[model samples]
Target: MSKGWWAVVAVAAATAACAKVEAPAASDAWIRLAAVPGRPAAGYFTLHGGRADTKLVGVSVASVPRVELHLSRMTVGDMMTMDATPAVDLPAGAALPFAPGGRHAMLFDVPPALTPGKTATMTFRFADGQTAAAEAKVVSAGASGPE
Candidate 1:
């Protein structure tokens, strides 16, 4: 091969190596309003991992005053408890589900304007410093959630 061709190939390889990994994605997002007034709402979704492994560190909604990640687990004596989690690990190409009775987001101080059939933008923060925003369908508390 010519020297110029070799140089071109080297540059191409370097560029490929420096390529950025895909950001994480969120789908099937929905927020269920609290069944009773003055209660925290719940948010659920499926977080699709990016091209590399990362940690889901936080989530936020512009309308909501506070949001926190939580895990619901069945404790002893058939009791259920929800614990606040700092982060959730996400492997490459994995789908992490946030559903009822499992991992979910507790959206506190939700505005009254967020009614059923409305949509709210939720931003997912990753450890890699990337943020993914998805609009969450607002549903009534009695609703079964997104399909």
Candidate 2:
């Protein structure tokens, strides 16, 4: 109603418009070496959730046939198994961990060029159509993850 009130509202609107929240960021991404070349490899990374909650609907990597989110959990008393999942839910400001012997990505049919000291591009798609891209470095066969 008042001129001062209107000015404050306009400034608030401008600030909100400038702060566009985006999808989570992938950091410390790396691909663990597979004993046999061309075999499936495991990937580890840390997902730093954005200002808003999001869902990881899909993933893709160069020179890889298939990329899927996987979970390793104990089943049937003492046995552990891995299974593919459709999507990964990410809460705001959450730190989702992906590592060996835990939740991680299964990179199927990876090429030999993805050996240690090499890098690969990985694109992650979110449910809102937003995407996050990161570089995945190839680590040693006995390594766990990025430093």
Candidate 3:
């Protein structure tokens, strides 16, 4: 084989190796609740991927009646808005953070008496049909700290 042909072969092999799907790292994940008046509560967290090409498909919380992934953005008129995101993509070795005024999870219809410091278990579903459970502590709205 010529030198150029060998070089091409090596590059192809490297590319293929890099393209393999890796399992997501479910550890070190957390969600913080943000205060909202007379509406559903919002939570933010960091989703870290152990390997490349992992996407978060769905999320469910036992505490809340319903949970969904929501993306909040500002419209042209400087109005804040939100919409449901089908999925949140987390590339390998990447962390997708849900923060205030950004991507977050919506916990709808929470019980009226729910309070901060309560712990809720959430199951996160990934694109590869894998599910991981994460524990989130409820905090008061505007309580900002490390997630």
Query: Which residue pairs overlap in candidate 3's backbone?
Result: 25-50, 35-141, 51-92, 52-92
lDDT of 2 by residue, 5-36 (tens): 99999999999987977558888888887787
For candidate 3, give the lDDT: 0.75
Worst 10 residues of 2 by lDDT: 138-147
For each candidate, give its TM-score against the true structure: 0.87, 0.84, 0.72
Model 1: per-residue Cα lDDT over 77-113, one tens digit each:
8999999999999999999999999999999999899
Rank order (by lDDT, best first): 1, 2, 3
Q: Model 3 off-target regions past 4 Å?
A: 1-22, 26-38, 145-147
Instruction: Report how far residue 69 has shifted in candidate 3, in Å.
Output: 0.7
Number of clashing pairs, model 1? 0
CA shift of 94, model 3, Å: 0.9
lDDT by residue (tens digit), candidate 3, 76-138: 999999999989888878877877788888888877566777777778889988777777777
